[model samples]
Target: MGFTNENAGYIAAQTAKRFLDAGYSVRGTVRKLASARPLLEDGLKEYSQAGKFEVVEVPDITVDGAFDEAVKDVTAIAHMASPVSFFFKDPEPVLHAAINGTKTILNSALKAGPQLQTVVYTSSITAVKSAKEPHYVYDESDWNDYAEKEVERLGKDTPGPIIYSASKVAAEKAFWAFREEKKPSFTMTAINPVFVIGPPLIAPKTESAVGETIRLIWTVFSGAPFPLPVNGFNFTVDVRDVAALMLYIASSAAGGPQAIADILRKELPETRGRIAEGNPGKGYNKEYTVPDGEIDINSEKGKALLGGWIPYEKSVVDTAKSFVGLV
Candidate 1:
């Protein structure tokens, strides 16, 4: 089941379509029918055109019995539903939702037992890399140590944006711990992506994190208020590519959790550059500014395991041009 109608939802729908096209039945779960209408319509349309797609309404993760009904008879599960927010004053909501939501999904999978053969958990690069460190590059092995401290310091006197990095780290640790203890019958994989950018399945008007980022880039290029942060650098990945990888991981016989992480790192740099270049209407400052911190991802393991999922070389420029209505 995928969460809200954002990047994860878009990617999940695309992955479901591929499965449907491949002659497999696909089921998607969302919190509400109203909010999920766009995805439902898109899925229904795809199924109407070709393939089998079904969207089921599931209770919010915060509620009890939410996962019970969602996981019934499912052969595999993609646990991507988690609380995602750009800014937060309280960490409790985000942290509770993320941590508890993961537990709920995993618990459901555990209950499903042998019926669930594969489970893919969507994680973030925030869980792996520290923003405080000046490391030029990072790999899957690195964990973000500075996120919590920064959040605490920034929010010392007042409510501040909850550190997503800290929440991710805690959630991931919980997931691994659950996996080790319960020893579920299914194969588990986690895909950690950096800044995800691509053509929206909906449009530029939608209020999404990626959309907002795109809008910011637009403002920057259009010569609007351009207070570009010089202290933020991150890797990027196309949503389409991420969706393809998720599907591949779901279906691949040889690939597993570690393999997924490896691929992400190996492809990080190329992906980042592509997403940045894909910003449409490019007329902003030409100066390549670096943030106060550096985030590097190494995906060598992914390449080695997945037989080299090469990132498109023109991804950056192409993405920028496409975003700017040039493509």
Candidate 2:
């Protein structure tokens, strides 16, 4: 799902690659078949065999029964797609798309019957925690009720991040609620990934064509002012890890933008003057960068999910090299 998403495109393709690599057929869902088909096909061209991959359109994901036919006979599902547009200025559309898109899938999954043994939901760290929270360790049980309250109170005035936080919370809640109430045969699980970083699996044609996260990294790496104001929350995981599974804070933090600049300069000499040296001598301090609410992670659990973590340094360097290689 969301095979064309700026952030999730790689996830979708990589997920498809894993499935196709294992000799299973994959059916990807998109809002528009014409625009997304070629992109997904091209993205998975290396690993997907002729009859092993196909795409179907589910133009309106918010509607009930939208995924009925798409879900038919499928064994497992990775619901990584969402219907919300990137311009999340309006809360109503965001809420509707997030909640309803999730419901529609659950409804279709139920309609698919016992054949569907698993439904792995694509959830964000936003669903688990909010930027507004102080430094504290968070685990899977936590919920970002702060963002939901703000969305309810702030409406269109809410900040973009908070709005996104609220939407993820609501949608994932909707997903779990359906599972608990319906008790469908599929095992319902939501993978809540933090700031995702790494080189794009599919090379973008232009700098402006990269995903939102990489775009943010590019803004800082190119010595350009942020296209928008970003906060100082920088905890991160690699995009490849997120797909196989699944940064904002700044200076002196783990996965910080300044860290990206420094790595580029150290690993790629060409960045000497091309990228600004915001700060030097900083190290990757996970505890220092841990959000105020804190975090609780099981080394074994995380390894099982992403097959072990990809170091943030590698993710940063690879992202820079990818952008430089972009046409």
Q: Which candidate is the best by lDDT?
A: 2
Once fitted onto the true fold, the runs of candidate 1 whose alpha carbons sit more than 4 angstroms away are: 1-8, 48-51, 131-136, 149-162, 205-210, 220-230, 247-295, 304-327
* Tens digit per residue, CA lDDT, model 1, 147-176: 666656765332332366767777887788
lDDT tens digits, residues 144-257, model 2?
A: 778899988988998877778888989988988897898887787788776667787677777767777667677766767424334434666777666666311111124566
CA lDDT of each prediction against the hidden true structure: 0.55, 0.68
Error of 1 at 281 (Å): 15
Deviating ranges (above 4 Å) for candidate 2: 1-8, 46-49, 83-87, 131-135, 225-232, 246-253, 283-300, 304-307
TM-score of decoy 1: 0.72
